[model samples]
Target chain A: MKRLDIIRRAGRNLKQAKVRTLLTALAISVGAFTLTLSLAIGAGTREYFAKFLETNVNPQSLFVVADKKLVGFEGGNTGPKEYDPGAANISGSSYKTLGQSDLDKIAANKNISSVQPNYNLEATYFTYQGNSKKFTGQVGMYDKTIRGEAAAGSLPKLGTMIGADDIVVPESYLKALGIKNAKDAIGKTITVHVVQQAQTKTTEELQALYAQGGLDALTAATQGKSQDVSFKISAVAAKPATALSDNVQLNISDTRAQELADFTTQGTSQHKRYIAAIAMVKDGVKPETVKAELEKTGLTVKTARDLQGILFTVVNVVQGIVAGFGILALLASIFGIINTQYISVLERTGQIGLMKALGMSNRAIGRLFRYEAAWIGFLGAILGALGGIGLGTLLNPWISRKMSLGAGSHLLIFQPLPICLLILALVLVAIVAGWFPSRKAARLDPIEALRTE
Target chain B: MIELKGVTKTYGKGGNTFTALDNINLTIPDAAVVAVVGKSGSGKSTLMHIMSGLDRPSEGSVTVSGRNLHDLKKKELDQFRAREISFIFQSFFVQGGDSCYDNVSLPLEIAGVPRSKRQQRVEKALESVELTDKTRQKAKNLSGGQKQRLAIARAIAGQPRILFADEPTGNLDSATGAVVEKLLFDYARANKATLVVVTHDQDLAAKCDIQIHVKDGRITEVKQ
Candidate 1:
């Protein structure tokens, strides 16, 4: 028999058993819906992370930090030793910070083009026309590539070292200072008082002062004698809002930051330390090679791509779990196909006999049954994919809003190739599920089948 | 012509065996109307099955239209039956869920007749059975006589050289049975096709050109 005729007959047979065919197809749709949704979510998350990286990270830059084991006594201790008063206690661990020598060693590498140390500065109160306010503040060197959009005035030019008297404030500072607009504050000057331990002659002497008087004795010693530095506001920057870091209100040049540390530690023996540094690699050099060379110097190196890779791995795991469940549902539906097809064969025994008596080949009979299964699969996949896309579209707005993603961002994104491949795969699965039952129908004895009423 | 020489068919294995046909020897010339009449379990149906290549004989051979049925493989036999032979069953066996048009088109479809040609042949077959006006009605909705006629239309749709009717009117009333019988015989005679009828009705058997009687799994008489 011709394939078209067999397919038409199969369609007619399915129509004859409408309820059974529909129920079987429904079972397959459940699996298809889940599979499509999972794939969409995986694609959406990847796109989202890719955008985040593009917007916030510089591909050629690597963040270098002191190795955790070298920076902390928290992991395990070799032995207890005498304590040092000059060591900084950070996150419940006392460790020496990265200093000028560490920065120099990293900069000396052939692959590294430049190094910018992230300064850990002491906080101070801001004073403007006798009104003083304490706010959470940190001063960091500004890299032109890392700066966000400017709300007022222009960002200081790249490679222009910030003078000791230059400063940049966030938009929140303008609101707090009662400045009418960011442009108005750009040329104004503000005084920041640097409080210190009153310039002790030696490390032992400063340690004695800290132990005897704590903060009050130190404050009394520096009473009526704080160094007030006046700085002109170079620009007012837009608020930095991201999941990782925000709430910074001050920016300065790396040279100016080092100068403030020098002023505070005058007449003392302690050297300035940094928490981390950013190494900007030259273009066309592999970041991995630079990272490996830096790692040899006992520093931990991480590129933006590495962090993005971690996020991708996490997203892939989630997609895998969801797809696994979808496959399980499909496996269950396969049995449903087999069951429905077997029952159909039994019910149509006399018809089978009639066809065979009319000289229909066994291969033709098998093809008919398989064609019916393929039809069911096609219907199920199309319905399930459309359902998934519809539900995703309906839920996109609420999900985007909840996540604070801007308008037009989607949490479920569909791509054409994967969806089509998924549908084809499901059809193949249905064909495989129908194989045994179709073969049984094909091999049935015409005499016996005709005798079956 | 259809010929069976020393043919035997057995069911089951070992000690549980039962013979459905025993040493059957028969020949019916082309375009002849032959009736195989017998009581139930007397091997009339088995003889028809073997001769039609629907069942294989355990011993000896059956031949039809110069093709040895035993020499042909199963697939070859299917092709032979599809192109050369047709059947009308006692139960009608018309696909009830299908329309009369589809029921009549089955054999032609199996023969791989194109749609355009199949349409013409189907219409002619339906007209021959006098069911042309009911072509689109579902087979289940047809009366017994109409369903029987639909079966005859399907059987002859491929224009096969041989026709087999197994108790074709057994389920119909006397009046409906006579109408169905007349259509079957008329189509076969018009086409000059060999017609074999399996029946228990002596009156119906008497109308055929040749009669064969069977008893105890063997043919006891052949009268022409």
Candidate 2:
């Protein structure tokens, strides 16, 4: 008999025993339902991480901080135990700071493609030319990793730094800068002010100044200096200034940030101290390998993978628990398939004998039963997947709202390709479950089968 | 033509065995109607099975249409039976859920006949049995006589050279039995196909051209 004919016959036979077929398929659907849900969650969480990584940083970039034995989210807490002199206190907790020499050591490595020291640039106020009214906001340097897409001008080319004279303004800053929009703001200049402390007069110098004039002269010699710098508005970034986010940030070039850092902390202890550094690994080199090299030199490094693990730790555990139930359900359903096929083989013994007497080969008889199992698997997976996807689609908005996730980001995302592959795999598993029963059916003696009544 | 030589079939193994057929030598000529009449344990069903290539003899050889059953591979034996032989059992093995047309076309479908060719053959076989109007009816809805006739239609649809009837009328009344028996004989004689009837009824055996009597696993008499 032709294979297609056998399959048709098998399908017809399954239809005749609808209750048994459905019960077996239901068993498999139990597993498929849970598995689909788990997979959706896994895909959803992973997608957010991927989107976050691309916009903020690249995979090759690792956040390098001093090996301070840090275990807290900056300034949260650290149960007091050890007090090392090397660990400097910031806000409340202590952490080792990255020094100039430490930066030099990292820059000298063979695998270090580039290093960008995270500079703390503080601008007291900023105003456009002819606009004396100054707006105080957050000021930071334009590191290439902060990939804020442009609203007016082009971003720096990949693997390059912003020019020293350039500063990027936000669309929201147009009103304060007296410009209509980003186009008008381009090529305009803005002034930033920072106070530079003067050197303290020594005792002998103070005594000579006091003798020359009075207390007034000494006071004049030790007063702080106020300096102002202006930079051209190069571009307007799209992401930095949203209406809801009132904390505006103005970005200056790396050279400008360095200049501000040099002058502001000229006499202070924080002149050469840095909070962290971002190291770029060379192309074709693994970040973890270089991270290991950096760790050997007492510098703590974190790759993107480690951060993802930390970020997804809770979600992953939940997924594993749900997937465990799915696996257990699948294991039980395999037996359900075997039992169903065995009962079918037993009930159809007389039919099998008659088919054999009618010249249907034993191989065809076996194929008929196996095809029935495959059909059951296809049905179960589709039903289960549809159920999972349907429920997920309906619940996604509610879930996001309850979890306080941002708009347009759902808690569950169903990817098409893996779902298709999952269905295929379930079908194969059903075939394997039907194996022994089909073999038994094929090897039955026609003479004995005919006498089975 | 079919031939059997020194055929011995036994059941069980080693210490305990029951001989079904003992050293039976028989030859069936072409287009002949023959009956092997026997009591309940005479192994008449075993003889039909071996001759139809549904079972093999424990010893000796059986050949049909110049192909020895023992020499044929498993696939070839199935093909040979599909093309050259057909059977009608006492219990009317037509599928109860199937239509009369589907019942008749079972042998042809098993033989891999194309769909375009099967419809004509099935209708013709149903017409020959005078059940053309009932072709669309399910086999279970037919009377005992109609069921047996449907079995005959199934047997002859593929036009096999040999037909084996194992108590073809055992489940029907005399009038119904007579109708089934007449259709079987008329079709065999009209088509010039060999017919082998296995039964315990002496009256049915007498209707055939030849009769062989069996007792205690051995042939006791031959009437030709």
Candidate 3:
């Protein structure tokens, strides 16, 4: 018989057994729907989660903690221990020094694109005023490591440094010190007290006393007793609110003073210590490669995924298990097709006999049955796939509304290859399921079939 | 012309082998009505199956129009059947749930007859059997006699050279069976095609131009 005739006949037969056929098709469709939805959802989740992480954290930056050997400390400095004054928090280097030499070696590393070394400093001084005040303050110095452009004014140049020694005071300081306009403070000189240990001689005290005269009369009066030293201010810099450095009340006057300052804090003071470096890799270089290089320096480097920790692993495992269950549902639907085809054969026995009597060869009979089964499977799969996509789209809003974290599910794009593969799989199952019944129908003896009531 | 030369069809193997057509040799001339009469399991239906090219003979060849039916491949035999052979069954072998017209149009459709022209041929064939008025009626709703006429209309719709009827009137009452038998012989006579009928009714067999008596898979008598 012609294929069109066979198809028409098969369609009529299905219509005859409408309830059963519909039920079977429904089972197959449900299986396909769940399978498709699971795969799409899993894919979208991965893409969305990865995108979220990328947005929240820097994609091309490496985090650097202090290398103990690089710290030049004899004892290993490891783990996070809070700085408690009662606890002997002795610094192997009195000065928090990751001096210029260490910065040079880091810059020379092959993958190192640009380096931003950070240090904090605190100092104390006597004021001209009778009352002495201690400056337990902090400072951070970075070289062009700021994340974005300053909202106002020209940015400081690459060589321009912000340190406790070169204080770019925050706007809060303007309010606290009763300074007028920020521009007026620029180029103005002020005396800051610098305190020293008892071992320092009278020459240092006299020098500090002379510098206090530069301070405002009130500040000068308080320096001799409470403030230890005074210094000349060169420039007052503009500062944004998130600035990382403390006020620079005093800076080294000459190379001799700097050397003396470095030596004084070398063995005992943990204050003014620098422990971390944050660097940016060049645009083309991968952040991962920089991280690997940093690890070799005995410093633990971290990436976004590392920081995300157990959450990333858990997401992947959950998706896998859910997909596995969906696969099981798909398999059961295939078996459901087999059962439906078998039942269909039993119901169509008389029809088979009639076709055979009409001079339909065994081959024609086989083709008819096979085509019937295949049509059922193909239609079921198509409807199921469409339903799956529709359901996924519908559920997207509900999921997103229920949990804001589920936002970004647009990552669940339907992949063409998987959909095609699913259709092909259904076709295969249909053909296989039809095989036995088709053969049985074809093998029917004409005389025996005619004899059937 | 149809000729069965020493045709033998055996079933099963080992000790269970039973010959359904035991060395049955017969010749049916063109444009003649022939009836094969036998009891149940007498191998009359087997004879029709082999003659219609729906089956293969195990030990012999069936020749029609000088071509060996046994020699044709499965697909070639199917085309041969669609083009030259047709069938009528006693229990009305119309596809159920379809209109009588669709059942009659089925063979023509399978033969790839053009739809624009198929209706005319189907109408003429149905009219030959006096079923033109019932064309839109479902086969399931037709009386036994009407369904048998519909089956006969379906069998002859493609204008085949030969028609095989397996107890074509067996399910009808005597009056209805007579009507169906008359229709079959009349159509075959008008078309000048060979007609082969298998029936247990002696009266039905008597109406044919020739008769073959099959007893226990063997033809015991052939009367002309």
Candidate 4:
């Protein structure tokens, strides 16, 4: 039969059982809507969160320790002798630190991309207007500074001996400390107390002290208990600030904050107090490939993704559940379509028989039923998609408010690509749901159907 | 031509077995009008169904236009029925929800006739049934006589070699049924199609070229 003729006939048949068809269409649409909305929202949230984290830090930074035999005991009095914590080196002694020469080599490689030097000092504090503000700060102490900069003060001149006096603080710290202006904090003296672990005290006490007063106080306590070096104030320096999370302002300089042994403090001996020299590539560069290259150099490179495995996992789980709901909805909708079509079939038994008596092939009859169902599903999907997007838009503000996710000023982020994908998914569900019943109707025994009184 | 040989149709299994048709043999030739007269449970409808390939007999075989009905798959059987036969019911089973034109055009449409051809054919059929003016009207709007004529028009439109009419006048009053009967004969004569009407009405059976009496799933006699 001409497709047009079949369509016309199908349309007539559908009208004969209008209520049933509509109900089925509604059910299918609900299912499709659920599936689409869940997957889309979940995926979108992941993308947004990942980007937020990536923009703030080096996604491919790695830390490599020079420990060849490191191990730890679960209890203080161990059943087995504990090896040095950083002694298990991923690479041998032939492995070198990612110094200037290594960075120069990395820069030459096309895949290596941009590499920035990293130095983090923990025993840092800034003193503004004679009041000392203690905070944990990473001292990049870069031959070239990457991102850490005072919201107000100029970067210290290179090789100008940034010592126990020069420091910069993060904008957030300035805000938290009730310093509305960054200018009030410049030319300030800060103290950085580098605390090396002592043979005289246990690691637990040192950790407790570090956690209580940060690196500066921990270093001072360690020094008081063993080494006799008075902690002094240093110049103030700023830390990186972002809208995503909270950060503390730190005091940092180019030189050692304290006259502590480099190996004892910056080495395996000081397990709790560690500083990693992380090199960050630009945002667009592929972190994974560069990470592999860094791995080859015996430096343990990791993506921000690897470091935030827990966060990523949690987000994924949430998204998965939401998507599962969406899938369930789509499935429910599909069953709804099937149910509606089945009712239609029951109502149109006589009509189907009449068509067969008039010389319709089973295939033709099947096609008619299928066409009717498909039309219903297609309509439902289109409508459901519109409904879902509208719902997403409507719920955006409420969702953001509840989630506390700062999705900019717009309430609904109508991501066209995600929405399009959702629509496609819903349509597929609608179509699949219509399949079985349409076939069943098509395969009905002509005589039995005709005899359906 | 349609032929049935040793056809037996049994329902259920073992002790519950009941034969709807028992070793029935019959032949219906092209351009001939034949009628089967029987009571409600006399196997007339069963015979009609088997002849139309709507059901396969438990035993024996049926052939129409040299093709065995039992051998065709369900889909193939449907195709065969669409291409080779048209069936009319006593109730004048036009789809009530659709316009008369849509009802009459259904068979042609199902056969995948182009829309233009379907419209032309439907118009012609409606004209033949003298319901051309009512083509756009829903089947439910037509009178009883008009509905019967619409059914007749639909049956004839497909140009099938064999036309099976099951109590084509069963639901109509005598006067209306007479008119419908005349239209059936006229349709058969005009198209040179074989007509097989299964009915219990003696008057209707007498009008055909040949008449067969059915009793208890068996044929008792044939008259011509």
Write the residue-wise lDDT of candidate 1 on B166-205 in tens digits. 9998999999999988987898799999999999999899
Share of reference contacts found in each model: 0.81, 0.48, 0.35, 0.73
- TM-score for chain A, prediction 2: 0.59
Query: Which runs of model 2 end up more than 4 angstroms from their true locations?
Result: A56-61, A65-101, A107-321, B134-137
DockQ of each: 0.69, 0.41, 0.28, 0.59
TM-score of 4: 0.73
Candidate 1 residue lDDT tens string, A188-274: 877766655454346676567679989786666554245766778878877533222343657766776666666665544344666
Better of 1 and 4 by DockQ: 1
Query: Which stretches in model 1 have alpha-carbon errors above 4 Å?
Result: A64-105, A116-277, A283-302
lDDT per residue as tens, model 3, A242-304: 222333333323332343344334433433334556666777788778778877865656555
Tens-digit lDDT track of model 2 for A1-453: 777767777776787788889999999998898899999998887776666655556678878889545422344456674876545566676677788888888888899888888776777788886687987877787767645668888679655677788888776677766777678777888889987777677899999999998988877778866779899888887653211133257788878888897787676666767778888999899999998998899988888777666557756887899889998999999999999999989987877887888788888888888998988887788888889999999999998777655677776999999889889988999889988899999999987777675
Q: In model 1, what is the error at residue A264, expressed in angstroms?
A: 15
Candidates ranked by DockQ: 1, 4, 2, 3
lDDT of 2 at A196: 74
Worst lDDT window (10 residues) for model 1 chain A? A239-248
lDDT of 4 at A294: 64
**Residue A301 in model 2: shift from native, Å?**
4.2
By DockQ, the best candidate is 1
Candidate 2 residue-wise lDDT, B1-224, digit = tens = 88999999999999899999999888888999999899988988898899999999999999888878999999999888888888888888777777888788778878999879999999999999999999999888999899999999999999989999988888899999999999999989999999999999999999999898888778888899
Model 3 alpha-carbon drift over 4 Å, by segment? A50-54, A62-107, A110-279, A283-320, A357-363, A405-425, B12-17, B112-120, B132-137
Per-candidate TM-scores read 0.78, 0.70, 0.66, 0.73
DockQ of 4: 0.59
